[model samples]
Target: MLADELQHKIDFKTKPLGALGHLEYLAHQIGMVQNTVSPELSNPHMVVFAADHGIAASGVSAYPQEVTYQMVMNFLGGGAAINVFCRQHNIAIKIVDAGVNFDFPAGLELMDKKVRKSSRNILEEPAMTSEEYRQALENGKSVVSEIAKTGCNIMGFGEMGIGNTSASSLMMSRLFDLPIVSCIGRGTGLNDTQLLHKIRILSEAIEKYPHIETADEIAETFGGLEIVQMMGAMKEAYDQNMLIMVDGFIASIAVAAVWKKDPQILNNCIFCHVSDENAHQTLLELLGQKALLNLNLRLGEGTGCALAYPLIQSAVNFLNEMSSFEDAHVSNKE
Candidate 1:
């Protein structure tokens, strides 16, 4: 369908012009994405990439690194907020062990795609070798390819890793050329002194990489396995023409990395929320995009994906199911 035709359909939806606000835009976008005025959502999925970061030992985050594994178990056991929201929205979530520091028995349901126990400290060396980075990207592509085989077309990216916020902050600083202090934020509820310590640690870490400019250099220099993998997954999802849902802060950094690789990849992305993290709003504005919701959400385990799913559904429903003025036999504007 032509873009003008899609806009006409949205404008005649038995309501005032633009009465639905963002929903009208969402309906038009989805119609364009699917190349159908009556687009239907199917097999909505969320993937949470879990890893451990070396910077967790440097006192950047309030939570211990062990919480990464603990939360993986929480996701497996269906006891986390992502679980609740996905259950409510009928979206399936998959937890991938991108590079957590722990090992699980073979009987567990997790996808054992670990690249390493943990990435190397960014303050000392590159997070992962070039080969490892390539492998992580391929592993991510493999995961999404399998999901696509199952006919899942809509996907969201989430992440879990202690000290990942530090990685994200450093990435933002490098990507936007913004000051490190502007991108830093409290992770896992850091108190005043702990937040100050995080700032100091990240500032020192930034000094180690002075010449990193390209996307690959910035990503390899300071990315968690989960973040890099999420970037790959996002690229693959866009390649398949699937709808991409982006979660909060850490997850957004992964999306940013994908944007660096190919700016057009964003055409398929629906940013799920504006994270409560301080830098998240700034990053969103820099990208010239608006999220579907706010809710002051900072939890990263794809919670925004699940919460935003209903609104996406509403957009599809109105476009396909709601009658236009002619269909409803209502009078049109003279």
Candidate 2:
């Protein structure tokens, strides 16, 4: 079998067995994902989906809702952290306006896949109508398809939306059968009073929709536009057999939703990092996944994905380029 072949090849590398630790597992995983002993990452891209959340009006986040579009502009202008990191790593970056409220001018160099101005306030009603949810999902799939046509076999998903952590927290609670308070976090640096207020507001929102039982129901009921769109992108990426690098809290929630529908997708996914967000680690544990890094990152711009890209490259590089014990004339441990 290919698994055994890959493991045997890895075990014979010129080093003590398992000395390379996680890197060996990563190489094996990449080999399995690509179904090749010699796998290569090609045309890697980072897609940042930006949108607005109505719950931002409820003060769930420290930043105002307008920051969503403002940050999108920052991304387009190459001023965001994601841009810096992607540029540093030579990975292509794409900006997506999933559902930000502002109407960007023509020729802004964005993917222009907006589903709506912004999702409805989850505190009062469903975050999006059924049709809007469908549109967001389709937009996500379409964007990924376009990227795949460019021969990009590996991609990471990042999100920018005010009050999105609230949506993520609610989805985590519903999908994992955890309490909303346990899922809630101090998004965008909420203070003690602000965090408590967010918890209260989310608790009430959960009570408002006591019947949202399924992942789709919970997502459509509470997911931000970018979050729902990310779910679609992840599913499409898995279909394309591409390596999927997932970013922090909001992105992970979308992943959890997609994983709930089809567990097989997990094999193609690499959780990039554990965010400082309170429940991110819990969410990872619930998904039976571990992140590649834990830099106390709270930034949600696919920064983790860009930061971890080299390590992924190292995994693939060593698998295909490193010398074997036989090649190096090193005696094997008996």
Best by TM-score: 2
List the candidate 1 regions with Cα displacement exceeding 4 Å: none
Least accurate 10 contiguous residues by lDDT in model 1: 29-38
Q: Which stretches of candidate 2 lie over 4 Å from their true place?
A: none
Model 2 lowest lDDT segment of ten: 209-218
lDDT of 2 by residue, 1-37 (tens): 9999999989999989999888898899999999999
C-alpha TM-scores of all predictions = 0.99, 0.99
- For residue 8, model 2's alpha carbon misses the true position, in angstroms, by 0.7
As a whole number from 0 to 100, the lDDT of residue 308 in candidate 1 is: 94
Q: lDDT of candidate 2 vs native?
A: 0.94
Predicted candidate 1 versus true structure: per-residue lDDT over 1-334, tens digit per residue: 4689989999998999989999998888887778887788889999999999988888899898999999999999999999899999899889999999998878888988999998888878888899889989989998899899989889999999998999999999999999999999987889999999999989999888899898888888899999999988989998899999999998888888879879988788899899999999999998888999999988899999899999999999998888999999999787
Best by lDDT: 2
